[model samples]
Target: MNNFVKTTVLGGLIFLTPIVLVVAIVGKGFSLVHGLAKPALQVLSVETVLGAATIHIVSVVLLVLLCFLAGLYSRTAGAGRLGNWLEKRLLEKIPTYPLLKAKLRSALQPEQLETLQPIMVRFDDSWQFALLVEQVKPDASLVFLPGAPDAWSGSVCIVSGDRVEPLDVSVQRIIQLMKRLGEGAAPDLSQLRFGAHEA
Candidate 1:
C-alpha cells in the first residue's frame, strides 16, 4: 500500500512537473514586470511626462532598442575581441579567477581534447577507475573523475604515471556520458567490448 502511494505520487510528478514549471515561470515574469511598472508609473505620473500605458509602451520600446544594440555589438568583431580581452584581464586580477577559468575552460574545451588519452587510476593495485585528462604538468595531472551530479568538473590530483592507466576512448563518448549521467556513472566498457567482438 505504501509503495503504491509512492509510485502514484512519483508518476504524477513526472507527468505534471513541466506544466507546473512553465506556469510558475510565466507567473513570476508577469509579477516582476508589474512590480517594475508600478514604481515607474508613479514617478512618470507625478511629472505628467507619460500616462501609465504610454510609460509601459515606452519602457518596452527602450528595452527592445537596447536589446537590438546589444545583439549588434555581440556580432561585431571589435566587440568580440574587446570582450575576450576584458575577460582575460579581469581573470588575471582576481585571486580565485584562475580556478574559475580552469573549470570554464575544461567545460568548454573541444570534444577532441577528451580523446587524447584516458587516465587509468588503480586503487590498492586492484580497483581501477578511468578519468579524462584536463591538464597535465611535469609532476601533477588534472583528471576529471566522473562523479554523480556533475562530471565536467572533478578532482585535480598529482598522480604518477605508474598509478595511471591510459585508455583509447573518444572525447565525444566521454562528454556524452558526463552530460547524461553526471559524474557518478560512466560508459559501460564491457558492453562496448562485447559489441566490438560481435561485429
Candidate 2:
C-alpha cells in the first residue's frame, strides 16, 4: 500500500509539471500585455477609435514604437552606460543573481581562458567523457558541466591543466555535439591531429 501510494504520487507529478509550467508562462504573458496596454489605452482614449480592432492596432503600434526608441537610446553613448548601470543594479538586487552570474560566466568564458592546460578524463569514471579546463596556482577555476534542461544546474568540479587532455576542437563543434549527444559524449579528436614530423 505504501509503495502504491508513492508510485501514484510520482506519476501525478510527472503529468502535472508541464501543465503547471505552461499555465505559469501564459499568466505571466497576459499580465505583461495588460500592464503595457492599460496605461497606453487610458492616455490615448480608446473610445475615440473606430472599434476594438482600431484600439488593438494603435496599442500594438505604440508598443513597437516604444521598443524601437528604447533600443535606439540604449545604443547611444550616454544612454548605453545608463542602461548598463540600471541592469547591473537590478541584477544585484535579485536573490538569484549570484547563481545566474556564476553559471553564465562559466559557459561564456573565452577559449583563451582555458589555455593553462587540458586533460582528458573519463568524467566521473563513467561512459561520459569531458575535456577539463586546468587552473593555475593559487587561483583555481571551476567548470560547470551543463546537464539536460537547465544548463545552470550542473556538476561543479575543480580541475587543473595537467589533468585534462586538450582536444583540438572548435567551441562551436563542441556545442553542436553536446546538443546532439549530451554531456555523456566526447567529440572524435583523432581525425584533427596533424601529421607526425619525419626524423
Candidate topping lDDT: 1
Model 1: pairs clashing at backbone N, Cα or C within 3 Å: 120-165, 146-183, 147-183, 147-184, 148-183, 148-184
Worst 10 residues of 1 by lDDT: 190-199
The residue pairs in collision within model 2 are 118-164, 118-165, 119-164, 119-165, 120-164, 120-165, 134-160, 134-161, 135-160
lDDT of 1 by residue, 1-199 (tens): 9999997787566445545654675567555656676677677664445555665565566555655788799789999998789878774674434444544456666653654465556545342335646547665566656432234334555566555655556555555565665343345453222222121
Question: What is the C-alpha lDDT profile of model 2 across 117-171, one tens digit per residue?
Answer: 3223333333222434444455444544644333333465765533344556554
Q: What TM-score would each prediction reach against the true structure? A: 0.38, 0.46
Q: Residue 97 of candidate 2: its Cα lDDT? A: 51
Against the hidden true structure, what lDDT does model 2 obtain?
Answer: 0.53
Candidate that would win on TM-score: 2
